[model samples]
Target: MRVKVNALILISVFALSSCKTQVLPENTVQTDIKQVVNSADVVLVDVRIPEQYAEATAKDAVNIPLAELSNNIDSLKGKKVVVFCNKGIQADQAVEILKKKGVDVYDGTTWKNVKAIQEEK
Candidate 1:
């Protein structure tokens, strides 16, 4: 019937719209505290405001805060982007955004975790 056809169309549209790009695991991420500090081909982005990044950010961390993530997305295309925030909230949000946009992104999470991981090295 017409109603069934309409419902099928609606479901198809919903499924297509809800489709999300692939999300690589955090471990597969190439950018970490060690790679950031030791000088490598890493795309370490601080998803915080410029002020927060300038206050005391990781070495060689590029400032592409969450607010400007969408606009500056092109710069992240086809690259391994690792995002982080002060306490992991914003970074998690950023990871979702980047994944939807079909970017290869990793969650760097909190500074405490980054420091701890680095110390363990």
Candidate 2:
């Protein structure tokens, strides 16, 4: 019985370990969104649904949902990008994707923070 329980625990551990995961950087560089917004060279990408983007987003931010990011990678290449979502979850994922493709991207995390940065003097 003890051996069976141990085997079950080991199997559960293995199952959990095999799941795909994305880890955020422990020391991510602070994203100066205000600076990005003011710069003509930078592109602000809001990686939320179109409806969410239409409801609220930073000025000049483009709507490209996380699922559609890969399709638009070519257009985003060779440019400074700042990514933000409703919260930070999808934004972090988008940052990871962009970084893998050699895009200079800043993970802006929450939209509220990005908005505040834009509003700051």
lDDT of 1 by residue, 1-121 (tens): 9999999999999999899898977745565445643335658788888998888766567888898999988989888777788989999999899988888777778655554555665
| Candidate number with greatest lDDT | 2
Which sections of candidate 2 miss by over 4 Å? 1-33
Q: How large is the C-alpha RMSD of every model relative to the true structure?
A: 7.5, 6.6
C-alpha TM-score for every candidate: 0.63, 0.71
What value of lDDT does candidate 1 attain over all alpha carbons? 0.77
**Which stretches of candidate 1 lie above 4 Å from their native place?**
1-39, 115-121
lDDT of 2 by residue, 39-104 (tens): 779888999999999999987899999999999999999898999998799999999999888888
